[model samples]
Target: MSLLKVRDLSIHFQSRQGILEAVRGISFDLERGQTLGVVGESGCGKSITNLAIMGLLSDNGQVHASEVTFEGLDLLKLREKQWQKIRGKEMAMIFQDPMSALNPSFTVGYQLEETLKIHEPQLTKVDREVRCLELLKQVGIPAPESRLSSYAHELSGGMSQRVMIAMAIACKPKLLIADEPTTALDVTIQDQILRLLKELQDAYNMAMIFVTHDLGVVAKVSDNIQVMYAGEIVESAPTRELIERPQHPYTRGLLRSLPGAKETAFRAPLTSIPGIVPALNARPLGCQFHPRCDFASEKCQHQPILTELRDEASTHLLRCHHPQEEVL
Candidate 1:
């Protein structure tokens, strides 16, 4: 059974510009010990989806979800006090930027200890301190005893990220939403972090939603992948299935644009879909991707419902009138 299930979730921000729909009716599931990668370009609502799931989006943002059930409990309907109990103990989030996420004034140890205290206030100071040091070591920080005493500024980018991960998993959450967890890290560091998370997930059997713009990263970590575009999922399939046989034009374009693809080198300067994403205040009348899609037809301008594309595979779904030439 799925540990976390999200169905038709929509998160909108009512701003001075207008009501911007950041996440528009997206859905996915995460099973125990599996990583579900939410992949998309910038401003495609990947982070917003994570925020909605974590219940961290601002008050200005309105969330509408058909259902957000974590372990069969309706997360959307939870009271603030109830959510507080569940937040650290059952679900935790590793945010995008560690520099901005961590407090400069407090030592990493204090923050991590506080995280545990919030959930299990019964812990003694010595116990919390010991637990904090242990968590730091588990995240692969060198000399974690000393590192815990160091402030956020005292750590390198990769080290700070590990601290953030330690803080997140302090209470051993059942599900971890890691948003661009290794975005600014070097390639080697990224691999290290990903491997660490994978190891921890296996050890704890924790489900994860790993969000990133890099398909390469998703290729390495994800058990399943959901491709988002213009606030909606354009394509979703098992990780290997999506990579080996992409069906949607957008998915195919993304695959083709990979740096090492031989066909990409032969294509016209590496084709990129033209036109900016449609304004959320005034979203296109039909398929959201139609504006940038080369295979758009008159039917595409008539609001095609996202539905099953392949009869053989129940898991793969897409929203496109004329899906690109199947590169399966």
Candidate 2:
């Protein structure tokens, strides 16, 4: 069985303007030791989808699903208490901003130990300290013992992120959700973090859900990729397949927008999608991407169901009235 199964999951938030659907019905399965990358522009619901799965959505947020099973347990049916037992121990998340995620008042060691205390209560203080050092070392923090006494503010952005990664994996979770974990770092630092995550995932044999806006970054780490738009998945396929043969217009636009996508000379202009993503409350009817799609037609006024391409066994899926045949 898949390690994680989500069927027709939707998320809505209560607001003064009325309920806003942040995530429309979306379904996907994840197997053990596999990496699934969710990519899209900001506010495309990539983060919100994973937040709902982690049971971390706000009280005003409502999650409905036909099925959300994790390790054979029904996630939608789990209570806060039940989730607390499974959350950090079984699965953990690395937030976009590590500085904000870490508490300023506490030393790094205290925070790391607190996680161990909550999740691995059987460990004695000495064991917890040893594990904490090991975690910091594992994440490549220099002088793990000394860094332990430093506060969040004392660490650099890269170091802070490393600390976050350490805490998230301290319990040796079976699944890891990295929600733009490298976004706040420099390009070099981002590359380092990505390599670190890949190594850790391999070492621990953990399934991962990596959420990011950078298709290039996702291409490096994901076994499969899901491109979301306007709270819905527009395309999904094996990483290489989707990268080389993107069918959805939005996916093509994203790829074309990447720097050096066209392999032009230095200082050449980059391609960009025409318009901004629509507000949730003001989203257009039918296909949400039609407004920005260059190839949109009258038929695009109606939403397209996600359909498989090539054959019944093909893994490439697309939700488009005019799926592209030519490779971008």
Candidate 3:
């Protein structure tokens, strides 16, 4: 059985103007011991999608799905009490900004133990402390013992992220959701954190959903990649395949903005996809990405549903009216 399966999952926010469909019908599966990167521009609903899966979306948001199953249980149907047992135990999320994600007043140790206290209540106080120390060490935080007593304010941004990672993995969750885990850190620290997460995933045989805006970071860690746009998945394939042979114009546009394409040797100006993502409540009549697409035509005004193509090693999915015949 797949470790996680999500099908036709959609989210909408109720507002005075109208309902804003933040996530359109989308689906994917995650196998055990694999990394799936969700990459998109800011405000493209990458974080909100995971938030819905984790049952963290605000009350104003409405989620509906044919199936959002994790280990055979439909997450869409789970209540808060049931989710309490799953969140932080079977699954955990590492937020983008650790300093804001963590509690300001609590010591790091207390926050770390809360995961165990809720899920592994049988563990004794000393055992919890021992496990917490091990987790800190596992994430490569120096002076683990001393740092346990420190507050979030005391640690640097990178250190705070390590603490967050430790807390997320304390229970050895089967699934890990990392939402821009290295967002604010320096380049050196960013590389270290990515390396650490990759090591941890391999050691634990964990399935991870890594969300980020940078293709560079996704390249470093993901085995598979999903490119999202305007609350929908525009392209998905094995990382190498997607990089070597992107089928969607949007995916091609994103790749064009990457660092290597900007070099003088390429000599070509780095071109970005024109226009902004459409507003959710005011979505375009056809393809949501039509206004910004280089190859859009009158037919593109009607949204093209996701279509799957089988490749030698993996399936590639794309949502586009003109995947093969774009003049540009």
Candidate 4:
């Protein structure tokens, strides 16, 4: 059975104007010990989708889902108190900004100790501290014992991010939702963090939802890839298949835009899909990506539902009125 099953999930924000649909009935699954990369440009609802799954959306945000099942339970129906028990125990989240997520006043050790207190309250103080140090060490932090006493501001960006990862994995949660965890780190540090995550995933046998805007990052970490646009999944496929033969125009554009090591002068200019993502308050009716999709047809104005684009058992799915052959 899939570790997580998200089906027909919709999220809307109640505003003065009206409802702003942020996620429009998207569906996907994450099997045990697999990483599902949710990729998109900024404001494309990648983060929101993870947040919704984690039940971390703002108070004004309302989720309407047929089901968000994790371990045979419907997460969407869980009460706040009920979900709290599951949040850091059965599942955990790694926010994008570790600095913001970690308390400015508390030491890293204290923050992690607090998480332990909440989830594993039965553990004695000494046991909790020992576990915290072990977690820090597992994440490759040197002098883990001393690092615990350091404040959030005292640690470098990379160290703080590692600490955050440690805290998320402290409970050995079966599922981890990482929201652009490496977005703010330098390229070198980013690789280290990605490697650390993969290591942890393997060691813990955990399933993960990796939310990222970088296709390169997606390629590095994902088992399966879901390319979202505006507020819906535009395409999905096994990682290699998606990268080699993207079925949606948006997905193709994302791959083409990735920076390469080729000679800059001879390389084609990175192509971007034109037009801003539609405002949530005034999202496009038919195809959310139509205004920017080069292959959009009149039929797109009627909203192209997601469908398998070919006769073969491609596994890849796309939402497009006019699909194109793979670009060389």
TM for every model, in the order presented, reads 0.95, 0.96, 0.96, 0.95
Instruction: Tell me the TM-score of model 3.
Output: 0.96
lDDT per model, in order? Answer: 0.86, 0.93, 0.90, 0.88
Per-residue lDDT of 1-328 in model 1, one digit per residue for the tens?
A: 6899889999989999888888888887888888899999888999888888878788999999999999999999988899899997899988768877899999988898889889999999999988998898899999988987899888888898999889888888999999999998999999999999999999899989999999999999998899998899989888988898887888887887666775544445765667777767778878888778888888887876678765645588878777654563
Residues 1-328 of candidate 4 have per-residue lDDT tens digits of 7889988889888889898888897988889899999998788888888888888888998998888999888897889999899998899999888888889998999999988999998999999999999999999999998998999989988999999999999999999999999998999999999999999999999999999888889899999999998889999989998887777888887777667825435656877668787888888779988888888778889988888766756578888877767553
- In terms of lDDT, which candidate is strongest? 2
**How does candidate 3 score on lDDT?**
0.90
| Model 2 stretches astray by more than 4 angstroms | 262-269, 312-314
> For model 1, how many clashes?
0
Question: Candidate 2, residues 1-328: lDDT per residue as tens digits?
Answer: 9999999999999999999999998999999899999999899999999999999999999999999999899999888999998898899999989989999999999999999999999999999999999999999999999999999999999999999999999998989999999988999999999999999999999999999988779999999999999999999999999998888999988888777754756778777899899999999988999999999999999999987886635598899999987968
RMSD of each: 1.7, 1.4, 1.9, 1.6
Candidate 2 root-mean-square deviation in Å: 1.4
